[model samples]
Target: MHHAFQIADREINVALSRARTGYRLHLGERIVPVDLRTGADGRAWLTLGDAHIEVVVATRGDDVFVHLDGEAHHLRYRHPLDRLAAAAAGHAEDQIRAPMPGSIVSVAVAPGDAVTQGQVLLVMESMKMETTITAPRDGVIATVNYQPGQTFDRDALLLSLEPMETCA
Candidate 1:
């Protein structure tokens, strides 16, 4: 099984395989574990390479709420496994992805549009919920692949932006 989740504007992918069962994670590095379990109390307990982490996961429609160390966080969705594969496959520097599977509800910019970092680029609808996609850095829109009412898979490239060249 494979999964994807998002944090802020970053995408993370995870791949799980069985027997010798293991889960692989792509988070700036490869993380492999022998076992994983979700507790009845809504916490996920993972044992990987002698490291242990307790994660609390909550899913409401398409929105995910996570709490760790008393800090609450909400994420769209992303697959660390896909991210790892993409990195290994050489897509290291490029536009970011949607991070989760959803329908594009609105596109805020078109090709040739200049945008600043943190600008809202589009809105996506998932499980009846809406999530906004934003620009990660200042750049000009190179392309808009999907539009309003179109559905995309997790990690799907919704748009790409080209960095503005400095004249020096």
Candidate 2:
């Protein structure tokens, strides 16, 4: 079985072939192998190369709560394949967007603010789900595109960063 999944605007394709238990993933031209095993606790363990991931999935209709690495991730899984894609997308390395339509709950940063990578910049609420937008790099905020109480569409540009200059 082969399938495609989307998470945070990125797409990934997975194929389950020959061996059945072992699968091939086409992640943007990179072919990777995945192995799944069931442990004594009945949890699904995913192995990718030398790294291992333990996953616990709890679902409520289309919404799912996944626990891994001592952290809880709230996601909406429309399709079974999306679970893998969302997991692979992980966190953003650049700008963050509303995974779904949401309202701005708060603005935590301002224009010209110096923010460290991973610092929270704002909170968005949608379908009773609240998600935090964070800085993806160490830089000064060059622009802030929204304010508290405002609403944004998926892929809306919420902020921009000014790269720091090197001291010569």
Q: TM-score: which candidate is best?
A: 1
Predicted structure 2, TM vs. truth: 0.45
Which segments of candidate 2 are over 4 A away from where they belong? 1-94, 166-168
Q: lDDT value for candidate 1? A: 0.70
Q: Give the TM-scores of the predictions, in the order they appear.
A: 0.49, 0.45
State each candidate's clash count.
Answer: 15, 0
Instruction: Count backbone clashes in candidate 1.
Output: 15
Q: What are the per-residue Cα lDDT tens digits for candidate 2 across 49-111?
A: 567899777778766677878888776534432332243243332344455556888988887
Candidate 1 lDDT by residue in tens digits, 4-116: 66778875556555645565554445656556678888678756667776867779876798776668889875444345335323223446676567798889999888888
**lDDT values of the candidates?**
0.70, 0.65
